[model samples]
Target: MKKPKTTNRYCKFCKKRTSQKLAAVKTGTPSSLKRGSKYRMRKRGLNRGFGNKGKTSRGALGSWKRYGVKGSKKISLKYTCGDCKKVGLSANTIRSKKLQFE
Candidate 1:
């Protein structure tokens, strides 16, 4: 879907309608040093020598292709208020295969 680069929207910070810049909010990257990742590494026997690490040792139960996946993702919009210079996120989310800012 295509959207305008800027639009007039109600800004909570400004307490009035203002010209806002539109941008797509992207998902951030996960850090491998996190606790969950560390535990997964240990279970997968990627850390040290192991005899039998059980079911999780194989990592995933099946190939990624076997699991049903969604073609699109829920994307939210970020609005930068022209008056207050504060950032705000849209309450509603849009599900689309591709989002373009025009």
Candidate 2:
């Protein structure tokens, strides 16, 4: 997908319409200290000591590479106000194989 470098958009902070610069939003890596990561680590430890864990004892049937493939990537975009220098997030996410700014 090709997006315009600059577009006229409404600036909520400024309370008016202005020409804004378009930029893609990049996500940062997850922290190991997060709550989800800690819970997963505790769950794995519990399965190790138990005699019978039912279906979990068998573990995964196959490698993760064999399934759950996605066709496209979700891209997030944001616009920067030219006057106020404040950034605003786009309302919707785009799914595409490639994204380019024109």
Candidate 3:
């Protein structure tokens, strides 16, 4: 949380104090590559009619190996407007573990 190279703030299309330029809005999807437990597999059907095969979830005692992606990557802040150049987004949402805009 260190984004203050410029933040006079109030730039509703340059209506007042403008000089905002700190950005870091990296919003979603970055956890290596989500979903691949084979749809929690378990599909060996039609043994005497057709055919189908899939397997993965071995829970209850294996707990399905506890998959991945508990949810992450949600940081925001992209306020450009240096004078009606317009671009805003840092109204409210300030979770921080890291975010430094120099």
Candidate 4:
């Protein structure tokens, strides 16, 4: 696999990107882990429920849409400041500053 490109940019929260590093991300565990062993052994929907196809239901297109959700949920990796080690600023802020300097 190819590596992602990095540019000479300032991390406002960190104040600079000189010492930043890529942080490892982890995957979420299955919901079944929360149940007891006995419960896990019993097949789900064995009695009252229909088979997987008809039993499972989902909303139509745009049915689950919500408004005013914050941007933090959409971003995974954040730029950690090399100077102060803080991590919450918009990426556009960095880009605008770079353009101004150039």
Candidate 5:
């Protein structure tokens, strides 16, 4: 099999590429957690009696209805040079726009 493309790119926070490690993409939940206990599983409905109504449940609304809640999964990537952490969205957006990296 062909090897995956891995790059030793510089991290502004680290101020160097030598310390950068290959980060694997996290795809999904582990198999061991897939079969959650029956006692832990809660019923899905408008009135399941948790806190507020189930109307606020993440799965209840469509993407358009959810708006800001949708597409909000962000990965934290830290840099040592600036001693700061950057989120995935900002990093991806900057890269896509071809903006000059500092």
Candidate 6:
């Protein structure tokens, strides 16, 4: 088990140093959301060489892996100042498994 790291930093609004709570931040929208809700709507046109209505595995994952695995990105957290309630992120990229807030 690893210990959680918290930062005590300067808060501009509070005009003093304060404890900042760390939290994981997601970078972008989910993969399923990058495309519109395909199942929800009944589409009339072709999607990926076949009609969108049929329930089938498109084998897109196999072809997609031809490029090789992408690099694993470290999880980033948003640090919110306790005193001023202001949110801040690290100037440098820092990765953590989890953040335990007190």
Clashes of each: 0, 0, 0, 1, 4, 0
Point out where model 2 deviates above 4 Å: 32-68
Lowest lDDT sum, 10 consecutive residues, model 6, at 33-42
What TM-score, to 2 decimals, does candidate 6 have? 0.49
- TM for every model, in the order presented, reads 0.68, 0.66, 0.26, 0.29, 0.25, 0.49
Model 5, residue 11: C-alpha shift (Å): 2.7
Clashing pairs in 2: none
RMSD of 4: 10.7
- Which lDDT tens digits does candidate 5 get at residues 1-101? 12223334566555655433223233454334223322123323324655534333444343335536534344333332222343112254111212122
- lDDT minimum window of 10 residues, candidate 5: 93-102
| Model 5 misplacement above 4 A | 1-6, 24-60, 63-90, 93-102
User: Model 3's lDDT to the true fold?
Assistant: 0.60
Worst 10 residues of 4 by lDDT: 93-102
Model 3: per-residue Cα lDDT over 1-102, one tens digit each: 677767787887657887778777764533432344332232223333543323333433235555453443457778888777778887677666677766
lDDT of each: 0.76, 0.76, 0.60, 0.37, 0.35, 0.57
Residue 98 CA error for candidate 5 (Å)? 24
- Number of the candidate with higher lDDT, 3 or 4: 3
Model 5, residue 62: distance off in Å is 2.9
lDDT for 61 (candidate 4): 15
After best superposition, candidate 2 residue 84: deviation in angstroms?
0.5
* Candidate 6 lDDT score relative to the true structure: 0.57
